[model samples]
Target: MPRELVDYRDSEEALRASEARLHEAQAVGRMGDWELDRDTGSMSWSPQLFRLFERSSALGTPDLNEALGYYSLESVELTRAAFWAAIDTGNRRELEQTVLLPSGAERYHATTIVPVKDGSGRVCKLYGTTQDITERKLAEQELRRKTYEIEDLYQNAPCGYYSLDANGLIIRINDTQLRWQGYEREEVVGRMHAAELFSPASRALFGQVFRTFKRMGVLHNMDMELLRKDGSILNVLMSSTAIFDAQGNFVASRTVLSDNTDRKQLELERTAHATRLADLSRHMVDVQENERRKFASALHDHTSPNLAALQLTLTNLARALPPAALPGLQPLLDDAQALLLDTTSGIRDICTNLRPATLDYAGLIPAVQDYAQQFRLRTGIEVHLDTADFTMQLPSNVQSLLFRIAQEALTNCAKHARARNIRIHLSNRDTRLVMRIADDGVGFDPHHLGEAGTTSPGIGLITMRERAEFAGGRFSLRSHPQSGTEIKVTFDVGRSGVLRPARRASDFANGTTLPTGTQ
Candidate 1:
């Protein structure tokens, strides 16, 4: 049925159709055929060949010399030798040459030459095909240039870059990383394991995480110490991403090592500076306490006794005066007694304010209690002291620190808080001596305080914090605009607070109840 349906009328028509199809295919490929006669140095070109050269039928097919004219100077000589070689050897040859077009542009042409022979076994004509491969050749050149640029960038980037195989061996590393570790590429890659590049401590951590990394596929900001070839250490932060193949199998990891030595050194210096500042603060607090104690001792021992002696003298003198003299002496005696009494009271207050006798005689708890009572009386604020579970014979300096911080905090509350009630808490809980002063008052933001210009409060908060920290304790203050304020200080007293024989809590702060058990 198929044979009957096909119609074939003329063989010549079929041949013409076939040749037309071939011409269309060649044109699409930008290829044309050529032939040259060795005998006459003449040439023949295909229909597409003429079009490729941008010549019309009027300008007949170019001869050997005419075709040679299209090539650039260098290519022409090479093409000529290739043609002569093909003719002499009776074999085929191919070469690429830059050909100049009539339109004043250049194009790369790939030309192939083959020698044809007669039945008499002699060279006759040359047959070959030429293709305009300008686009392909230009593309190849561009690709090579870009590849070189990418390789340069990878080698010279600032951060150290490296890749590791699935076995944790170094597969590739950049010049920057190699230089940092004092190693050439030949010594490290494929020879050193990733763990060998790090210090022993870092190696332990890296070993553990590297397992997890293989599974998790990502890790970030891992601080590690790198051991250089010269036995020195370099701190580095490592971050990496795992690579996977097309079938979702883990293949390798790409890692970046960032130099962190400068940051590490800065941290060390900061710690040392903080330690020095703390030492200085403690020294200053000691000197201040000593001065207060000396001043208070002078008033209590010397001045108070002198005033009492004078009062006694005045009373005895009145008793010894005569009846007529007694009238005038009585007024003088009364005025002298009143003046001395006032002066004595003034001196006692100055001594108490400078360094309270209770702080030295009764220890920190009793001193704090006495001061709290005074603070309540002076400010007309209701004060509550809760040391019901607290009793310890702490070092005198520790006692002083706690007392000063409480005093400063209470003073600030009275002056700025505008509150009605205050609660002072001293307790030993969880092996720590914790003291908290809380007030129901108009509060302010602590952050704005002690800033460049001003804040809602004064430097009292700063002083309190310094005192607490200088004594190796932690201090915290919490205050908001509408909320109340609380200052807490904790000293790590351990179970020793419970170990020592304790005094009654009421001896210090009158209102506080002594512990039922400790009492």
Candidate 2:
């Protein structure tokens, strides 16, 4: 072949290769190029443009007006406007357009138009590129929706949320907490310290714990009182997590607060109700004791004296009549005297049991001793009173309550505990009193008390417990089969009311020694 012919063929081959590369690039990018002839209003499209509109290459590129039909109604107007603007201004324009394909499917495209001007600066042609952006657009829409949802949840959740800086200043706070404290966002965030939100006592507590919290990085369920804008207090349970810097230094904190005002109020009201009930019970016990004293006094002063006088008059009459018929009537007089003496003795015993004068005159120790003596005489149970460590002056109600509990305990031991011995131990410290009545008996289950079809300790035990509790003392019973029964009552002597069970007493119950003064 001639050199010119060979050169021409080589140039044509190079141009064909360049066209092939352009075609491949457009397909990979999901982009197509198009041009509009300004004078003829005809349009030309790349092969990718054909695919973009779902049209076959055989149908050929459509005219300007026909091409506009591929876009929806709104997009058509926008496309026309963009074309004219590019022609008028000779500037490149970019916009996103919605394209309706031949298959009734919608797609998103980013369209850029660059006006091609001739040498005279007259806009003779318009060229543009449309890239398929449907996937990117859908992904962006989903991301925006999720962002809005998360923001909404953060701002409107039921519990209060806030963030604090290392300096303990309020850095970020949510709308829910703003409403709770009756403050606007501007007033709280960045303007106030975290301690300002709490009452004086709670603020002091928070300050003390915050330093430790920074080192630990976590705090859970701390009770706090918040001072609201209106000067009222709100109770909340607060939890916090610390955010740290790269160096492990504390940077900020994320805190959540749960409102427990209603729960706190309920607790206070419950405590008040319990206090009232205890007061009423104590009053009733005092009243019952007073009535017993009056009844015993009346029998002792009037009934006993009258019975003794009647006995003497009957004796004198017997002596006067026995002179005439001494031998026959003497036995009848003796029987009458014996009946009178038994009646007098029974009345005296009843009076002593009702309100023992020793109890009122000599206090609890003597009262317990006297009652124990009588209990031993009646039931043949050996009683031991241990008061070697007790040396406090108790309130009258406490003394009475202890005596009554001891009395009931001994009575129960006599009735149920087929025991040979009882030990009544009394001990006290500065303000605490402990009394334990233990019996060496065949013990029964304490838990089964009052249950049907079970051998119980009986109502006497319940009465003893009530009496102890009514006087502001704690009562406990420990027993098991073959282990013996022990009844314990503890009181706060200073308060003359109930005391919580001491740990030492529990230790002692488990067969360990109590502190120095108690058994």
Candidate 3:
């Protein structure tokens, strides 16, 4: 072969190899190159450009006007302006354009335009590269949408969020917290300390605990009062997490605040309602006691006197008739006199039970002693009364309450316990007054009360408990089968509503135990 022919063949083969590599690179990158004749408006496109427009290569490259048709309506004018501007300024320009393909699908593209100038600096042709950027553009769009959603949620959440720097200055705060404190973002972000948001009292409390919280790294459900710009108070439950640096030193804190005003208001309302109910119950007890006293007084003054006079008149009539018909009428007089005496005794017993006059005159100790003696006589049960340690003089109502509780306990013992021995004890420890009544009897199960077909002693037990509670004392009962029954009532002598002291009860007692005689 001739030497010149061999060199030409080698050169042509190298050129073909370079063109093939260029085509492959364009295809892989989804990019294409094009050139436009400045004068004739003719255009030339690479093979990848044909694919990018979804057009057939057989048709060849179109003119500039025809090529612009491949772009979306909105992108057409923008692309034309860039081409013209490149020619006018003889400069390179880059733009993103939306392409409308033959298949009616839209694609995003990045185009770079360079103007070719001749020796006189007169632009002759324009060249540019277009890359299919659809996937990248879609990813960017999705990221922007998610960013917007996250920002919205952070700014408008139901609970307030704020962050403070290591120096306790408010560093970052969400919109919700700004609204809660009646502040603008600019007002609090860098100018105010976290503790400054609280009321004076709460500020002092927060100052005391905040240092501890920083070291602990977490805080939960701390109740706080926020002083708003409008001078109103907002109750809140605050929780916090501490942020630290690499060296394990505190750097910032993230805090959340939940509104607790409604719950606080509910608690206050419930307390007021309970107080009202207690007052009403105390008033009712007082009224009931007064009525019982009046009824007992009526029976003692009128009924007892009338029965005594009737017995005296019968005695006088018998004395007048005895001499004339002594033997025959003497038995009749004796029977009438016995009946009258028994009736008088029954009336006196009724009056005592209704309202023991000793309870009003001699206080609780003597009243309980007298009742216990009568209870022992009636039920054949041994009675033990111990008030050795009880030295406080209780309010009249408390004394009455304790006495009534003891009375009902004794009655239940007689009716249901079938007991043989009873002990009544009273004592005062510190500011508390305690009374206990116990019986050695066949006790029933406290839990199973009113469960079977038997008559439940629960009604009497309930009455005793109510009496104790209404007087602002605590009541408790203990009972078990084959064991015994015990009732305990405790009053807080320090509490005004529950109990109050005057002089010591020992002042009223004749001795350690009062005389157990009928009053």
Candidate 1 segments exceeding 4 Å error: 1-9, 50-59, 100-104, 243-251, 265-331, 351-363, 380-384, 388-401, 416-421, 428-433, 440-484, 490-519
Q: State the lDDT of candidate 2 residue by residue for 1-519, as single tens digits.
A: 999999999999999999889889999999999999999989999999999889899999899999989898999999989999999999999988999988999999999999999999999999989899999999999999999988888889888899999999999998988888899999998999999989999999999999999999999999999899998888999999999999999999999999989989987776665666666777787787888888999888988888889899998888678477988888988898899898887887788678888878999899889888878877899999999999888666667778888988988888888899999999988788889999999878765566788555658877886676655566787777777789888877655444332332222233211121223
What lDDT does each candidate get? 0.81, 0.84, 0.84
lDDT score for candidate 2 against the true structure: 0.84
Misplaced by over 4 Å in model 3 are 1-28, 56-62, 100-106, 316-353, 469-473, 493-519
**TM-score-best of 1 and 3:** 3
Residue by residue across 1-519, what tens digits does model 1's lDDT show?
355344444556787899999899889988999899988989999988887788887999888998899889999999999989998899999999998989998899898998999998787999899899999999998998888777776777777888999899999999988888899999999999999999999999999999889888998989999999998999999999999888777789999988998988987776555555555666677789999999899878998998999989988888888889988778888999999998997887788788899998988877877888878777898888898978666777677778888888888998889999899988886666888899999977765565575434557876776566655566677777677788887677545431121222222232212121210
lDDT of 3: 0.84
The ten-residue window of minimal lDDT in model 3 covers 510-519
lDDT of 1 at 34: 87
Question: What is the alpha-carbon lDDT of model 1 when measured against the actual structure?
Answer: 0.81
Off by over 4 Å in 2: 1-25, 54-60, 70-73, 100-106, 294-302, 315-334, 341-357, 447-455, 469-472, 494-519
Write down the TM-score of every candidate: 0.76, 0.85, 0.85
TM-score of 1: 0.76
